[model samples]
Target: MPTLTRLLSIIGLIVTGAVLSMYLLVSYVEPEPREIIVEIQKEGFE
Candidate 1:
C-alpha cells in the first residue's frame, strides 16, 4: 500500500491546512462590542 499511504498523507495535509487557516482567521479577526437593552414593568408602575 503505497497508494493507500499517499492517500492518507494527502488527506492529512488537507486537514492540517484547513485547521491552520481556521486558526489564523480566528486569531486575526475581532468582534465588535454591542450593548443590550432591557425594560421591566411592575404591577403599579408603567
Candidate 2:
C-alpha cells in the first residue's frame, strides 16, 4: 500500500509539472490572427 501511494504521488508530480510548463510556454508565445467568411441568404427573411 505504501508503494502504491508513493508511485501515485510521483506520477501526480510529473503531470502537474508538465501542465505548468505547457501553460507557461503558451502564455509567453504570440498567436496569429485568422480570417473567416460568412454568407447569409436574403431569401430567409421572406
TM-score of model number 2: 0.62
Q: For candidate 1, write residues 1-46 as lDDT tens digits.
A: 9999999999999999999987666556633212111122343365
Q: In each prediction, how many residue pairs overlap at the backbone (N, C-alpha, C within less than 3 A)?
A: 0, 0
> What is the Å distance of residue 29 in model 2 from its true position?
1.2
How far residue 43's Cα lies from its native spot in candidate 1, in Å, is 30
lDDT of 1: 0.65
Error of 2 at 37 (Å): 19
For model 2, where is the 10-residue window of minimal lDDT? 32-41
